[model samples]
Target: MAKNTSGRGQRELRVKVKTARGRKLSSTLWLERQLNDPYVQRAKREGYRGRAAFKIEEIDDKFRFLVPGARVVDLGCAPGGWLQIAVPRINALGEKSGKRMGRIIGIDLQEVEPVPGAEIHVLDFLEDDADDKVKGWLDGKADLVMSDMAAASSGHKQTDHLRIMALCEAAAYFAFDVLEEGGTFVAKVLAGGAEGDLQKVLKQKFTKVAYMKPGASRSDSSEKFVVATGFRG
Candidate 1:
């Protein structure tokens, strides 16, 4: 059994992990952090798929974009956490009386186990005519197009940053093609020098563009979310 290292109580308890012989130090550290993360515990208790759900929840709560009847597209929605959050907030189940039902469409390179009220597809959003396919599934334009996609890490920080930026730019273009006028685009991005170009493009197309690092994000991480609302086109 693991012991609490930060003093035990309802509010202050931290789990400590001892390194195992076969585990790399980095892996051990990650496991320890997961065990100690309050968001992880909260997610489990609240029946969410993972901690990343809170990041999107916080963003949507502040921005007021995931309303009832809004159509949403979630890019690279793996492990189905974001989908779980979206279903209830968007009233996809028609459980919210008097509110119109919403739609959720998610796509990824790999197959995701179905999320109850969401339509999850296995497709790379960057491929040819992918935007058309997504629109076909939704049957119309989306009110919001969001992405939590990050490229596979190359063990080189700068290289990884550029790759993710490229992915974000691609998602932005897809949003441009399929979003309704006054729509929204939300995506995760790393804080690096190369993001200026992406920001420029977003500013041109959106009435308001804001950057946020949600409280659920780690303090040491450079990841931030770019929320461009009030789409001009």
Candidate 2:
């Protein structure tokens, strides 16, 4: 953040990126946006891995899914920001006296520095029997299964949309297998016409399927989250 007293009494100014020889214009623009984003600053001060943590915080604030004693599985849980948000809300630390302690398991293809109070695993969730493995770790089935995964962007808007929708669909299917009856499933997705089929499938498996763009998500981003609850088993 910057200040410009020359204009008004004391106007707050957005941090601007100075062009550097080695940096691409796109990279510079992204850096400047990050510097100006309040959520990013809050994440740094609050000790969360990234601003993405607040997206889940806002969602759970409305839906109240991260209740005490809930068992949660995070797919592609790299960096573990969502796990950090879930830990305290779900009471995973047993610090909330008289509340049931929750359990959180996070899985990714690559290992992550463990979030305290979360079980981190390096298994790929899409491979055969992956659901069984997660269930074993949970000692049965999970109460919630969530993902914040997105495929590498191909730069083409339509292609990127289809790719992320595929990932969200896969995560939903995995949730179907691992979640106990009446559980919840949440995952990030890009808003585009290609999501219809995925929405149809989720509606079949879960009693309520809704979409939301949390306030923490950038207004310019097409990203949104699908929150399906009351899994029918």
Candidate 3:
């Protein structure tokens, strides 16, 4: 049984719709699982733009990244959940607070509603023009470059994994281009594991590179995060 911590049980309560009419079994199962997910209920209660915010939060708590005043860039930042977490964490240190002052800029192909203190741009990071736009917005190098982008699934497991790996590789290249020395880069990867070539490149560029799966991520999901810290520039 999922507890409604918000005290608004009625609002959080999802209708348990039985499979009816033409609804496929898989679709109905997916809907039922989502409805019963605790994180989804918490996200709704907390007013987060999306439940993905918790993944970043849990990752940060473990790694102690995203320090005060850090200049950060978020790739595939649609719905602005990560940005929502980044702003307060970055701002918390205040002036003269630390090595990196909070400055978060997010980019996505989809439009995201403005987050109070974040600079957001609507553009695909894969486009040639996108880098210049993000750089212009940043005005300097970034302390961290994080991406949660995943390619659309093809239902074929290997194909889907390869597509997401490609996205991660592209994101890493962009991270290398923009990250300041001693910076950090994080991106989502599938359980099939990162491509060997990409792993070799990341290991050479960063002092520490490791994979993590946060508690917010569904246990059954294959998703994991690759964190590369101490950028050598």
Candidate 4:
């Protein structure tokens, strides 16, 4: 079951969504969970595009990778939430006084609405030439490459786990190509038996690798983030 908010001066009367005549129970349950989720409400109140913005927010809060003057690349950057968070933190718009300006490029398979102070591209990061293209766009190697990509769910747990691990590994290899020496890579992955291989691979390339589950993530979710820093390039 999903958690709900309470306490004085906060929300009351948890929203209950009755199933429509043709709706599936899963759909009804999902709607109810979204309505009750505190992070979703906070996203609306704080002007983030979605709750996922907070995941990166929490991740970067600890890693401190989104510093001013850092050049960043965001793979699978749909809806532009990560870009929105990176812009100000990286000083993409030069809003911070006496801080170095930063640059970020976001790529996705679908066209995303433009986020101010960031560049967005419709691209698939798996293409053979994708790394070259991103290099061309950035005009230099990136200081950090991050991803929020996940494979489409097939409703089978093991298959889903393997699929996401494979995607995360691909993102890691892509990072190896475009990241500058000592850069960072952050990505999402599921917890499963096969992740040991992914960890082994990252350990070879990064000086430090750590995992974190942000508070914004649902307690029931299997998702966690891998933050690999000090790219050995």
Candidate 5:
């Protein structure tokens, strides 16, 4: 169990479970892992919207992507975690006189609480109308398009992987349509690698396409990020 040490004095509590209660082994393991994860505790102390913020932070640090004043679009940005990290970076640049003001737009089917300096919309990215809605909000081409979208797990690994791939492909298509020439796209994908067809398309459209798994992501997790930069459009 992780202790809350922020001077709030929140004690860690453990609940007893009976061995014969029929709880699944996977569920028990998941709960135990969450209880012990230091990042989870740190996220709580820092008031981040989610622990996923650290994943983006680690990736951005390594890649030197996500520059200040970049026009960034965050797909599937529920709970506004990524936006929370991005907004501050952009704002810091604007603090200097004559720097270009940055714009960040976020979309999710789930309603997100407003984050200062970001425009958010609630709509399913898979719907037929989603593209039009996002275009309208964008006002102009984006410098960066990023998605952390993940399909709900069905407990079947193959099915879940396919669903996530479908989402990634859809997001990639949208990125191709909306990103400016020389722009970038980043998305979350499963361990099987992006669908081959999608990889082929990204290679044709962008100067660089690569897959990265940040250190903040759990070793046991299959999630990785696909980054396509220097869009030809």
Candidate 6:
């Protein structure tokens, strides 16, 4: 039923989903892909909300920005997988003796189920006064401002790309206003031609801007993450 990639020479098993009377072909294909995805299986075994958790986990592992005591703000943090990973990594629970306690704030347009050690609010990050409100929640600037938000797909590929790029750009500016100097900004963006301006702005505002597609991300997906560190603000 599932592929095992644990051993070096093990054969991978691919699961096939047959379309049913009520299910669309696209839905069946998606289901099959999810069923065979190693990351999805790993998430279930590890008790994570979803596979997207590994994307942030791998990225933070390479960058090491989610250190103990770091104050993090997650934009559009729904389902709370990122929040769950951030809690322990950042020492938000104060369970790590001798480590400074960390804090995290999450905001989404819809109400999300609670994740221990994270403060989640039902608010849209794109609102005009959202940055100010976030600062109020954090009691100061944040050491990290990360986003995993993507616009609702319109089925038009180019239009979807533009929409995500715009959302990423807005998140960048919001980070500029609320991130601490020498902090980090991370967000997901679809690979498309319209990201030039977004990259340019991040370069101007951050000491280093790096792009990566974590191993947990689906290979066929165009999604990539932008990690901008050392915020000028």
**Model 2 per-residue lDDT tens digits across residues 1-233:** 68765686665578889989999999999999999899999999999999999999999999999999999999998888999999999999999999999999999999899899999999989899999999999999999999999999899999999999999989988998999999999999998899999989989999999989999999999999999999999
lDDT of 3 by residue, 7-35 (tens): 78565566686998999999999889877
Model 4 C-alpha lDDT per residue in residues 116-207, reported as the tens digit of each score: 98999998899999999999999999999999988999999999999999999999999999999999999999998889999999999999
lDDT of 4: 0.95
Could you tell me every candidate's TM-score relative to the true structure?
0.94, 0.95, 0.88, 0.95, 0.85, 0.94
lDDT winner between candidates 3 and 5: 3
Q: What is the lDDT of residue 214 in candidate 3?
A: 91
Candidate 1 residue spans exceeding 4 A from truth: 1-11
What lDDT score goes with residue 169 in model 4? 96
Comparison by lDDT, 3 against 4, better one? 4
What C-alpha RMSD separates each model from the true structure?
3.5, 2.9, 4.7, 4.4, 5.0, 3.8
* Model 4 misplaced stretches (Cα beyond 4 Å): 1-11
Compare the candidates by lDDT and give the number of the best one: 4
User: Global lDDT of each model?
Assistant: 0.94, 0.94, 0.87, 0.95, 0.83, 0.94
Residue 126 C-alpha lDDT in model 3: 77
lDDT of 2: 0.94
> Which ranges in model 3 have alpha carbons more than 4 Å from their true place?
1-15, 92-101
Tens-digit lDDT track of model 5 for 58-101: 87877666777788889989888899888876663366467667
Give the Cα error of residue 149 in candidate 1, in Å: 0.8
The weakest ten consecutive residues by lDDT in model 3 span 92-101
- Residue 39 CA displacement from its true place in model 4, Å: 0.4
